[model samples]
Target chain A: MRIEIPGEEYMVSGHLACPGCGAALSMRFALKALGGKIIVVLPACCWSIIAGPFPYSSLKVPIVHVAFETGGATGAGVKAALEMQGDTETTVVVWAGDGGTFDIGLQSLSGAAERNDDFIYVCYDNEAYMNTGMQRSSATPYLSWTTTTPANQPKENPKKDIMEIMAAHRIPYAATATIAYPEDFIRKLQQANSTRGFKFIHVLSPCPPGWRIDPELSIKISRLAVQSKIFPLYEVEGGEKYTMNFEPKGILVDEYIRLQGRFSHLSEGEIELIQENVDKEWNRLRKKAGG
Target chain B: MKKVLTGNQAVAHGVLLSRAEVISAYPITPQTTIVENLAELCADGILEAKFLRVESEHSALASIIGASMVGARTFTATSSQGLALMHEMLHWAAGSRLPIVMANVNRALGAPWNIWNDQTDSLSQRDTGWIQLYCENNQEVLDTVIQAYMIAEEVYIPVMVVLDAFFLSHTSEPVEIPEGGEVDKFLPKYHARYKCDVNDPHSFNLMVSPEYYQEFRYKIQYAMEEAKKVAKRVDDLFAKSFGRGYGPIEGHLCDDAEVILVTTGTVTSTSRGTIARMRERGVKVGLLKIKMFRPFPREEVKEALRGAQKVAVIDRNISFGCGGIFGHEIKATLCDEEKRPQVFDFVTGLGGRDVTPSLITEIIEYTCQNERPEGEIIWAGMRG
Candidate 1:
């Protein structure tokens, strides 16, 4: 069965993304939704490589490859210049990896959000710093096995709540998305492109190499994440009002964890702990959305 | 329009006349006044540009690059620690060949946190690929900013018009702020050949393999070398229109002198006064004010100081583990000379302790007497 997606594809073939890379699919879906009139600000990320080297770009849109920590600020700058030039049409999208968004780029991201600069900032979270050989970043999930976070000592803390951080800035729109649901991802991107102020979308992209999952299981594992309530799909309009995009089926978190080798060492007791934590977080999101 | 303005005000006025489309900066000592005045210019509708008040110096430079990528003429200002903070982005701006002109008020870097006039800060970024143009006074500070845009755009290299922290940035002086029409003739509107455009999408400064990386670096090197000629051509055109032009190297009374003192920034004026006093006492003394530091003015520096029997450098900053940065470059430039003059360095008045005319005269006298530096550097004005 073929799904009817947007006909216009902005991403070209022969790019440098890994096989079944969720970030690559996310970029494809994002560019399809945003269309041709756009500038993609890519920080130092997998997309930096995925966009190909100089004189070679897989992206059909203009790409401004900036410093890792300067994505938000650079997008704001491009938007400001466009506005000054009487160009209010072209949209500026800052597509950064999780490390750039949650850790190194947080200050500039926060500053841009606080100023309400007009641009769409999307964080394609692949759990860890995959570009630098899967180093553990602030966005790395709990008990995930990164190179730095070995099996003996995995990440101890939960992933940073970046959407809530953006919400605290009272931006016009903030949403969580995933490539498993193309409509949800495209809708959030379109919504962000429509609004005037700062719009942030946190896309939970999966990584086959970094997550230690089979190449074909990238989309399946991504779907399991949302289905198991580990990664919820939601939106916060006007920063204060939260709207749940989809309710999870309340499946066992074990299915999602067992799919990736990163969580292969997790005992049954640890799996129960993760379920309790996910349940508490889901309930909190529900309460915030007035469910 | 001749106006009595400080160096900071002059830079703002220059930026205004150049029609900068995007201005981004963070407030630092000495550099603060430049951006503050630019903000007022933006607010009063005098300058039509997008003013971005960034959180840090790093973002300020990044924002300027971002704006420049979209074919927007951009400008920014910073000093000392601020310039140091924008170190990484500085390389990006130059390597990308963005042609973003910036005014860097030169101040000493901090350990004890002193915000004073020193050349160390700007000189520290010598390897960052920015064309460094040190200003001698308010007029040069103003005119250099205008000239910088023209030079940067032509050579595709970013320019940093540097001035002494407070000596030039804060002190008011008579400077001819060129009219819009005059500046229009000097510097036309910036139209980027390859910028971020929706119609023609491309990536800028992306990762390059080892095979292609050397070529890109060589291109930057070619641009820098080409800038020396471009700087001269632009200044000549500027002189043709404005009746005043400072070249890459300026020689004052060096035609028939035995000892010449090399200086940069605001101290050039003091060197002039010291030379005049020495001339009154029948001493054969001359002055060489270096305006351009990046291309190092190598051949021109050698030619200017070649006539003298002895040459002395008054460096306000030291390059730790070595002598003055300028002294090292000067020696390296003149090393292949068979008839090169005896050279020495006088390290003095650091942290804005005031490099007076009397101090300069003493250095001149010392240069006239010594064949070469006895030790490494002559610590002038120090208690030791």
Candidate 2:
């Protein structure tokens, strides 16, 4: 298939992001899709380091490194201000980490979405707070190991249902994407770009250090997540309409869990329990998508 | 045309005349009226702007940031807790240098949940890289909003026009709303030199390593210092166009006064009134009204109080362990001077408590009679 992607490139090659950083790749693809006419609102996150320093930015587009939880609010303001100047063509994207999106930034994001603020809010979900050294976040999955949630007693709470929370706002568009699936991710971006009102794209990013996975297996793990129905690829329009983008192969959830060191300590029973949970979630999502 | 309007309405009219393209705000007491009026204007097509009704203060700031990124002239308003909620984005707006204008109705920060006048909320955000302007009355509120955009865009920094809650925000006074065409002539449409343009896309507000972060901070600081001159120039031009003038600090009867009262926001109005009353009673007292709080007119403040015998600072806000919020700032500004006035700090009118003229007279009288006390914060008007 000959796919004609975006002609302009906003991100440069010499970035300081860690190799196999899913968030960085997400930004790279986002810049490609949004083209040069973009303003990236970045809160405090790993991308902050990835964008390099002032006078030497990694992305070609203008970046606004804001506070940890101001991504959504700041983006809405920028968009409004741009429209005032009779320049509505430029796209304003709030690129935030899972911590910023799910926890500290939840209120702002909720406000923006509720108001139907015209902008793209992209949450690069690495599952934990990597910038501050692998601390626990609301996005952190259940039974995950981090500096805060040690191996002995992993994360007690389940990962927040961010997609559902965003979808609840009845936003114009809300979707889940991954770096492993570039074409699907890019396609979703195009769809969001075309739609008006609030658009949310939650990308499940794999962390090399935080996830304790082989640096090269980031894409493989991300793919496995979709295949095993652990992190299903789906979209919701107007909060009610749900559509599953790709059908899972119905593989055992262990296929996705065993590779990551953070989840290595899970026993057979625990794995079975996780598999049951995945199946139940898949059923619920399929039902929502009308099978 | 001159119209009798509350300080909130005057600010709203200033925003309307400024031709602001977008407004994103969440309702907070005192500041709610400003946005409510703006929303009404947008609805009535009097002000052609997009009014974004956000769910929270954070979203209000974020939405405006996005709007500003696209190069729109944006505005928003908040007070106390709402301002605190926008604390994180305040840093972002400044760091991004979006030149977004905000109206802050000064209120006390809560533990006891007070909604009265104080400078703690805005003053706490002193380091957020925004040009903070404190207005004493409705006229200043109206004029400052128009000039804030000019000064902010000139220096490429966000500006916050602060007014005391109830005193200025809810109080009514006559204000001259400048003609839109005249305002346009004075303050042209904001053309960001470094905005997010599709034609020339360049990364802004990116993360920087330690190697270059200092440079970014220095640039912000340099821009702020430059803003002081830009603020002066804009105020000068505004005066020339509107037939009125203002500065970082306004001195009232301070030339030959033995006691000077340093204050900000609407309290300055009461202080002026008290100065007149005291002057009638043979008291050599004057008033120093501080307009700009961020690029804190330190040199100007020192020069203004140079010949004064004693400087009594009456702050409407408390700094917890410290005496008065503004008092601490004033003392800090004059700390290294060769000869400083005997500074007395008095905390009063917290949580919207009244700052009547009689209280001001009594404070001045006490400061002139008693010796300066160390770390003493006399609670003005607190009856046992």
Candidate 3:
């Protein structure tokens, strides 16, 4: 078996992404897979600023910068317009952040999935609203310390199961991939590229700024998430069948949390409680995957 | 061909004739039938286009903006609340300079949730940079939508063709829909100076610094000013082909009159009968119909009301504690004139209340008789 990366690059250097910005790397990998025949519909997110200001862009492909909640809807429109022009080669990729996908953009995303509008919806989850200075999002994990969820009272609710929600739409394809696993990310994108109907890819993007981690640990944090089974990598097809992509080593969740300052405020009791919840979720996922 | 149609159906017919490549809409009262009929047109192959039944008005407008960015003619329709929901994207469409055409059925905004006709919904968005056109009847509704695309594309700005709720949207009237080929001959396929092209790539509507942002705002304002001329030119071309021309502002019997009643939307239709009745009594009064509300038509309005002693503006919408919206604009437009007419703001038929012929007649008499309105806003036909 061989691991290969696509030679072509759509995301060039000189972009404003910080050190170990997983979302930036995720886009770089996405563009490599999607190639030149794509248009990115971006809602307000980190990339809205990261892609540079007016009259300048980091990516080679065209970007349609829309409001925060309009990613899926805008992508559908762009795809339809291209179809009407008798040019269906270009793929409309809705690139959005966690807050956009899990909260404001949910209706639009669900609608697009229901219609099975021909486009790829990529929701890169950096855990919270990183662009707005580390506010909490529905996608923010339980016991995390975003600005909104301060150190005193960390995020109370568990991270939303967007994969399950999207799978319920019974879309053709729904997959999870992270930048730490480029081969996995690229493969999933290529799968989405080949699929005919609506496809969703959830990328577990790591943010150094909002996560209060050393910029060097962004990718390391992502690798530990999979290793600890806190953020599992998997795919769902037709909103029914679930396939686990990687098997975590059953490592302690503390190995992942200790590297990031967001979880530093948690006591021993809270850490154990989080570990128990992760075990329960892992057991349920394993059951579904026939482990 | 003469077909009796509701204002919504007229919009659908116009969209079909104009060959709008994409129609994205969500159903809201009064605006529902337009997209419903459009869906049928799409299904029957009468119109070769994609009809996107969106989840919400936000998505509806967002989708249209996307389609328009791809150099395809796009359209959508909604009313009051739905229009309000799409308010944020309205700026996006205008700022991106995408020439998308939309039909807005004028429904009242709600705290009590009213679905009737009122201009407040569209009037509230006057500063959004959309070229707003108020329709007088079903015929005008059908004609203006086609002209909206022409003007919108020419100036690279979005156009909103607005009509009153049930009075126009639900009321059936005879409309002469032009043939598709003839409309195509007049309004050709959209050719974009800039768009989302794959082979030829460029970023559209991205982040702007304070330094260059003002220049973009200036360009949109300049385009809006140009839209005034483009609207008239496209309307003239529409007339040359179809024999129906709707100027930005049309002054009726204003050649010599003491009082002029200014109206917009379907209320202008209701005002006509009152004007005729007043004329039989030998009262020298006239009607000034504002078809184009944006670019305000300052010159035409100034020229039309120059000699009139009293100019009464019958607004179906108010600016909340400030009097009527049109009243404010007309007053500001006439403030510097050497001999400006005393502009009185009279609000009538709000929240779909009936603006009857008798009411209009009484309003005309009141404006003619009083030197100044006793109050800033005269609420017509209110029992309380």
A218-248, model 2: which lDDT tens digit per residue? Answer: 8999999899898999999999999998887
Docking class of 1: medium
Model 1: DockQ against the native?
Answer: 0.80
Candidate 3, lDDT over the whole model: 0.91
Tens digits of per-residue lDDT for model 1, B1-384: 778999999999889999999999999997999999999999999899999988989999988899999989999999999999999999999988989999999888889899998888989899999999999999998889999999999988999999998898899999987779988977888888888999887878788899899988899999999999999999999999998999998999999999989999888998888799899999999889988999788999989988788889889889998988888888899899889888888888789999988888888888887778786688897765
* Per-residue lDDT of candidate 1, residues A1-291 (tens digit): 234579898899879999989999999999999999999998999999998876788888889999999997899889888988899999999999999999999988988898899999999999889998999999988877789989999889987888889888999999998899998888888889999899999999999998889999988988999999999999998879999988777688999999888898899988898889889999998999998
Which candidate achieves the best DockQ against the true structure?
3
| Candidate 3 wrong stretches, greater than 4 Å | none
Model 2 residue A52 CA deviation in Å: 2.5
At residue B295, candidate 1 shows an lDDT of 75
Model 1: CA > 4 A from native: A1-4
> Model 2, B1-384: lDDT tens per residue?
889999999889989989888898889998899999999999999999988888788778777876776677889999999999888778878887778999999998888888888778998898899999998889999999999999987888999999988888988998888888999999887776766666775666665568878888899999988988999999899889998888999999999989999888878877887788889989999899889988888889999999998999888777677667778888898899898888998888878888898899889989988877545788888976
lDDT to native, each model:
0.90, 0.86, 0.91
Q: lDDT, candidate 1, residue B346?
A: 85
Q: What is the TM-score of chain B alone in each candidate?
A: 0.99, 0.97, 0.98
Which ten contiguous residues of candidate 1 chain B have the minimum total lDDT? B375-384
